[model samples]
Target: MPQAKDHVYLDHNAGAPLRPGARERMVEVLSDVGNASSVHADGRRARARIEAAREQVAGLCKARTRAVTFVSGGTEANMTALTPNWQDQGAPYYLDRLLRGATEHPSVAAGGRFPASMQEVIPVDANGLIRLDILKDMLAGGGPALVSVMAANNETGVISPLAEIGAMVAEAGGFFHVDAVQAAGRMEIDMDAWQADAISLSAHKFGGPQGAGSLVVRSTARVPAPLMLGGGQENWRRAGTENVAAISGIGVAAEAAEKEAQDWARLAALRDRLEAGVREICPAVTIFGEEAPRLANTSCFAAPGISAETALIAFDLERLSLSSGSACSSGKVSVSHVLTAMGAEEATARCALRVSLGWNSTDADIDRFLEVWPQVVDRLNPEARNRAA
Candidate 1:
């Protein structure tokens, strides 16, 4: 195994390295002791910190400060938002159905509180983009539905047309919930522009602590019912003792991400270079969602006769961190649902690999990956190697 300094991390979609400011803020909060719910001075101080963080996190999505609710992570935020029952300004706003994108994260795919019978799947085209015409038809038939689609797919990095989808939902008198965990720091988030009812974000996806995330809504008047019930924390939406350190870390990360968002365009050049190098090595390599808009830092591709499990292990031994797809599956190398939804054959989906870069990624890192690619290809594909000879 290579030394830590030599290792190249290309899995930012899994979780970015914690930013220095986020780490510092976490340490600062951990050094103190205070309960945000307590009435004492210490408690008040803690409360102030949490509130400040709330504002910072909200700013990341261009949302109202009061509309933010701190949740455990992305999964919790999705579960909370995908509910059939919601309130519109203190009145019951019931959703008769849950219509979600076929390529949504597993959290949203599970349909949350909406029973299987009440849920429907919206299809995607071969480009991994939602079939909006089908979505229009689905909306026409359903009673005020809750439309759930991710802002950016984790596996393929494909970005959805959020503004268009949100407009359709609004016109149909439905609620639009965007799982924006992957899009948070990579794209501009304007709730007003998208007319999104709410969007979920995970701090870890953008360089904060893993446990902290937020569900930012366009309006507190329209919000999901509490998934966690007990105390009155989070304005009765989510009830638990505040994780001050993690939340503080999230604030620092959110602020940094918003300011640094413009710099991400540089990663697209790096990603293009990486993909071009792969294609040069294996002329027939498949790049998923290549025709669609994708996250600047991500590239998902597959080479013939190369299995993800083998490549991942080989890459790890070479001190190159890569992934087959989403890291949520406990490291299993399985066919990507995102690819499958886009009509990829099982063999191609099984061989898929994802390389994502972030703030610290450098040209040297991409160079290293290209240098290692040919060896992996030669070892895995004897036919290609013989042809090369």
Candidate 2:
């Protein structure tokens, strides 16, 4: 679907616009026919494409090409990683429990394959940072645990201290898995530096087409147990026919996103300007995780007395596309769990809105949104409007 001429998109964290290179690659693959599992000449070509994509994804994470296991998307990648059964050079390496950040995505909050009794939550500070002292105490009481945390938060754009968290997990002799879905193309990913056992990524979160992703393990020898178990696909790691077209798109997008990271500072400046504009209009606006290091392209804030649900409708009518929080909530606006975990009150949490930028986001887009801001406030918040007048 073509976007309206006047519409502006600012919801990169929900899913980035597909890169042109990725779109072209996907189109090329869609016209071809071959199952990657087959050994015929046609299949060999498809297999080569998949392998090449794996290498590109590995390069994004600074991991060995052999460590990348193609999956459906971020959710599947996380589910495949957060399991009790893992192997060290093909031997049974079991984890006794699961520990995840309280502000994690809903997929991580579900505890994946672990039972409720075996799962624990590590609290975050008021600024949405994980409490290191509390995490240290929790680790001391647990057996070989699997600690799952996102490299960057989807709602607040807060960057976690992955290296520190990884060191703590290593000291506890536990496994570490990072959901780098939001951080994949936006930030540098060094699996070794973070000492992460595995990191999950979704192609769509970057600039690829949806439906393709990967779980990149630090070592193929020490990987999670096979989540899918029917065929000898993905080196027996995951089963099912590969989405060759989507995988091709992922490779192209990965290559492009790597190049695009250099221009991220420009996006950061735009985000800063966007936030400043919001604060200027609504001086009482609260920016979540404002003091923490955040993704350069994200600005999540809530103005007091302006209901997010009401503002969203106004924004939509104004042809401004953004989100109140995570787009995963099936088209409904509700209180942000991320804000709540950071000790925000229910009223303030409900007002939270996330404005994330992307590779193609421009100053014009930010200006257009800022231009529409006061009108939205005036319509939904009459008291604030009167005070401003």
Candidate 3:
């Protein structure tokens, strides 16, 4: 599908534009023939492609090559990490409790394969920052727990204090898992530095194809049990034939994202400028997680009296692509769970919008938004428009 010349895409958080290298790599793999599980040369080649992708993904997190297990996407990676069936001396070991931050992506927030009765949700501060004190208290009362926290939030771009969380979990003798899907390509991740027992990643979040991701455990010797039982795929950690084409794209994309992180400062300036422009136009516009650490390319903000659904429709009509603060469900912009957890008023939460920039983003995209947004606010809040005028 050809894109309209005037159209602009700013919702990189939802899914980034596919990288050229990744696209080419995926197409190349699509032309190849063989199942990775077969013993023939064709199969051996396919297996090689899969292994290379695993190493590429592991390199992104500075994880051991043996620790990476390919999965379908972030959801599966998270599910595999959350399952309480890690092998300990050939016996099944289960986490006595499961805890997750309130602002985590739905995959982690849903408790993955863990039972709902065994799970507890941790609260976050009004700024959408995790409440460390609360987390510590929650851990104190629990047995060996599996604490899952996303390295960065998808909606607000708020970064968690991973090193601190990891330390606390380690001291409590619990395993710490990081859903680094949003953080993977945007920043450097060291499993040991964050003390993460396992980290989940998705290719589509970082300019790769969707449908391929990985769960990088800290050690191969103590990996989680497979969620599905069948073939010896993914070292018996996951059952299913590998999505070879998508995996190849993921490998190429990860390599590119790692290199692109070096030039993230360029996007930082663009993002800052975008946020500044919006605030200047509407003084009441409040940028979420502004006081907390955030991704360089992400800006989530809202103005009073202007719901995101209204603005999203206007922007879409204007050929400007942006996302609501929360996930868009069934073509509708629902109130942001992230904002609600931050103690934002219901109306304000409904008004929030997220604009995430990336490698393909340009000043023109921001310019278009700045131009169209005022018209939206004017229509939604005529009283505020009068005050601004």
Candidate 4:
């Protein structure tokens, strides 16, 4: 068992370590007692904090503060975005259809379960990029449609061309929804610039408190009927008392991340070093999405004959915490849907490991990982060592 002292987390993609600032903010908010919707002074203070968070989240996405709607997390954000508003008198007929990338996170994928005939999957290329031509074709043939494409792949970190896709969707008079949960804070995200009707973001992905996320909808965009209705919270789009503390933490974290955007460049350098070390130590290893632009702090790699589960366990034994893919899944060992969509062989997909970094990462952290990685790989696949010998 790895002790806390030995563990070097490389699973920021799963969730970054909550920053001290975010924690302090949470503590500060928790000490207060007020319902944001109430009319009292304390309530007004709470509402102010919530509004500040809305602005911060909106700024992160280059959206208007009024366009931001808080949700429980990425899953809720996705579900809310995908849900249709039958109540809208002018709702498009295509609103009945939900088209998404086949490699989308389970939340988006599961949203398709509403009815198979009403759902369509846009295929991806060998590099895990959505097949834009197919998307254009589908849009041209569409009904009222909701197209959900993740801005960046959670497993492979391959960025989707949202600007292009959003334009295509708009040309076809369809709603464009982007799952920016993984893309937020890692890269520039401009909801208006991308022309995205809606985008989802999770605070935990960028050093904020977990259980807090937001959906950004264009001011011109029509609201879907509420996914949950009661108490008329979130402008009646979502209902429930606000999570004031978590939202406050998200605001602090977003402000910190915005102020330190250059940190991503630094983390990219460390990521490159880690990747270079892995390639040097294991020449046969294949890095996924190497041909395309990716998140600065993510590197997904695969080595023949060594399953991700094995490598993960070996690394864990060495006190290096990493992920096989999205932490939303149960087991660390599974064939990566992203890899499969990208045309990776089952063996290669199963062998892939995702090493992600974040705000807490340092040069020494990367060095420590490089130091242990070779031994972990060797221990998991002694045959590779024997072959080299």
CA RMSD of each candidate after superposition? 1.9, 1.5, 1.6, 2.4
Q: Model 4, 1-389: lDDT tens per residue? A: 52386579999888888989999989999999889999999999999999999999888888888878889999888888786553334463337688899899999998732466788899998888899999888887857788899999988888898889988888888888899998877888887777888889899998998898988887634665557678788777789999999999999888877765545688789989998888777778889889988888899998778888878878877778898854445554767777888889988888888999888788988989989877876777755532331
Better of 2 and 3 by TM-score: 2
For candidate 4, the lDDT comes to 0.83
Model 4 lDDT-worst window of ten: 85-94
Model 1, 1-389: lDDT tens digits are: 43488899999998998999999989988988889999999999899999999999988888899999999999999999999899999898899999999999999999999999999999999988999999999999958999999999998889999999999999999999999999978888889999999899999999999988999889999999999999999999999999999999999999988876767668989999999888877778889999999899999998878888899988988989989954456767877788888999999888899999887899999999999888888777755432331
lDDT of 1: 0.90
Q: In model 2, how large is the Cα lDDT of residue 201?
A: 92
Candidate 1's displacement at residue 67, Å, is 0.8
Query: How much lDDT does each candidate structure score?
Result: 0.90, 0.90, 0.87, 0.83
Best by TM-score: 2
Please tell me which model should have the higher lDDT, number 3 or number 4: 3
How would you encode candidate 3's per-residue C-alpha lDDT over 190-218 as one tens digit per residue? 89989999999999999999888889988
Question: What's the lDDT for residue 296 in model 3?
Answer: 93
After superposing candidate 4 on the true structure, give the runs of residues whose Cα lies further than 4 Å from its correct spot: 1-3, 86-94, 112-114, 326-328, 383-389
Residue 378, candidate 4: Cα error in Å is: 1.9
Model 2: lDDT of residue 54:
91
For model 1, state the Cα shift of residue 274 in Å: 0.4
